[model samples]
Structure formats: structure tokens, C-alpha cells
Target: MTKRSRRTHSAGLKAKVALAALKGEKTLAELAQQYDVHPSQITAWKQQLVEHAADLFGGGK
Candidate 1:
């Protein structure tokens, strides 16, 4: 069996995936399959988005 190489995702894709996760329109497994990413990674991205969302509005101060 050939080993899979580690892939890097762009920031735009990460934001899109995280936004999709936050929409609650689909399950994590579905999102993972669609985006070719692990559900745990999606969860982490979603969490990161939620945690830092306030910073976008200058509310982090």
C-alpha cells in the first residue's frame, strides 16, 4: 500500500469549511466526506472560528 502524503489546506478553504460546519445544515461526517477532511479537524476549525469570531468585530479588547 502506498502511504498518503500530508496535504495543506488554504486559509480560504478552511474558512469555508468552518462556515459550513457552523451552518448546522449537514452532519460532521458528511462535511468531512465532502471536504475530504477528518471530522475532528472540522470540529476544531469550527471551534476556532467560534472562539475568534469576536476578534473580527474588534471585540477582543
Candidate 2:
């Protein structure tokens, strides 16, 4: 039996992937394969980016 180890991604990497997703230039599956992350994770990151986009414009202090 083989066990999978947990992988940790840096904030910068997450942001990069999320931005790629936002660009809509590639499918989520393609992004996942290129980034070596799960599609679901990419989806979550995209959602987070969308939800927090206003924060970048002084919405949050």
C-alpha cells in the first residue's frame, strides 16, 4: 500500500495559480496539471480571490 504525503504551497504560488485561473486562458484541469495541484484547490483559491478582490481596493483596513 502507498500513502500520499501532504503538500504545502506557498502564498505566492497560490496567488499565481489563482491568477491563471482568473485569466480564463486555460481549463481548471490544465491549470491543475501545470501547477501540480488539485482542481478543487484551484477552484477554492479562485473563489477566495474573488471574495477578497475588494480588499485590495481599500475595502479592508
Candidate 3:
């Protein structure tokens, strides 16, 4: 049997998927299916986006 390799996603891709999740146009399950990521991962990204949004404005972490 062959071993399956782990997939690595870029930050930009994760941010894009998380943005789509924050938009509320689609459910987490649907987003997961479309992006090939787990719903929990999407949720974590979304939460991170919200929590760190202030950093984008130079508010600092």
C-alpha cells in the first residue's frame, strides 16, 4: 500500500477560503467541499481573520 502525502496550502489560499466563509453566502460544509478542507479548519481561519483584523490597520497584535 502506498502512503498518502500531506497537502500544504498557502496562506493566501487559506485567507481566500476564510474570506469566503466570512461572507456567509455559503455554509461551512459547502465551503469545505469546494475548497477540499475541513470545516473546522475553515472555522479556525475565520476566527483568526477576525481576531487579527486589527493588525491589518497597524493596531498590532
Candidate 4:
């Protein structure tokens, strides 16, 4: 039998998934299913977004 390779997602994809979760339109389980990732992973990405959201605009021009 052939071995299955581990799946990996990029930062952009994680950010997109996190944004979708933040929208509150779907449950975590649904998001996980849609993205084909673990719910905990999505939760971590969402938390990271929340923690750094201000940084995106906080930089002084």
C-alpha cells in the first residue's frame, strides 16, 4: 500500500479561511469541511488574525 502524504496549506489560504470563520456565516465544523483542514487549525489562524489585525494598519505612513 502506498503511504499518504501530509497536507499543508499556505498563509494566504489560512488567512482566507480565518476571515471566512470570522464572518460568522458558518460553524467551525462546516468551515473545516469546506477547507479540508482541522477545526483547531482554523481556530488558531482566526486567533492569529485577531491578534494581529491592528498591525495591518497600525504602521505609520
Tens digit of lDDT per residue, candidate 3, span 11-59? Answer: 9999999999999999999999999999999999999999899899986
lDDT of candidate 1 over 1-61, digit per residue (tens) = 9998999999899999999999999999999999999999999999999999999899777
The sequence of per-residue lDDT tens digits that candidate 4 reaches over residues 1-61 is 9997898889899999999999999999999999899999999999999999888899833
The better-scoring model by TM-score among 1 and 3 is: 1
Q: Which ten residues in a row have the lowest lDDT in candidate 1?
A: 52-61
Evaluation by lDDT, superior candidate among 1 and 3? 1
lDDT-based ranking: 2, 1, 3, 4
Model 4 TM-score relative to the real fold: 0.83
In terms of lDDT, the poorest run of 10 residues in model 4 is: 52-61
Give per-model TM-scores: 0.90, 0.90, 0.85, 0.83
* Candidate 2 weakest lDDT stretch, 10 residues: 52-61
TM-score-better candidate, 2 vs 4: 2
- Per-residue lDDT of 9 in model 3: 86
The segments of candidate 1 whose C-alpha lies over 4 angstroms from its true place after superposition are: none
Q: What's the lDDT of the predicted structure labeled candidate 3?
A: 0.94
10 residues in a row with least lDDT, candidate 3 = 52-61
Clashing pairs in 4: none
Query: Per-residue CA lDDT of candidate 2, range 1-60, in tens?
Result: 999799899989999999999999999999999999999999999999999988999769
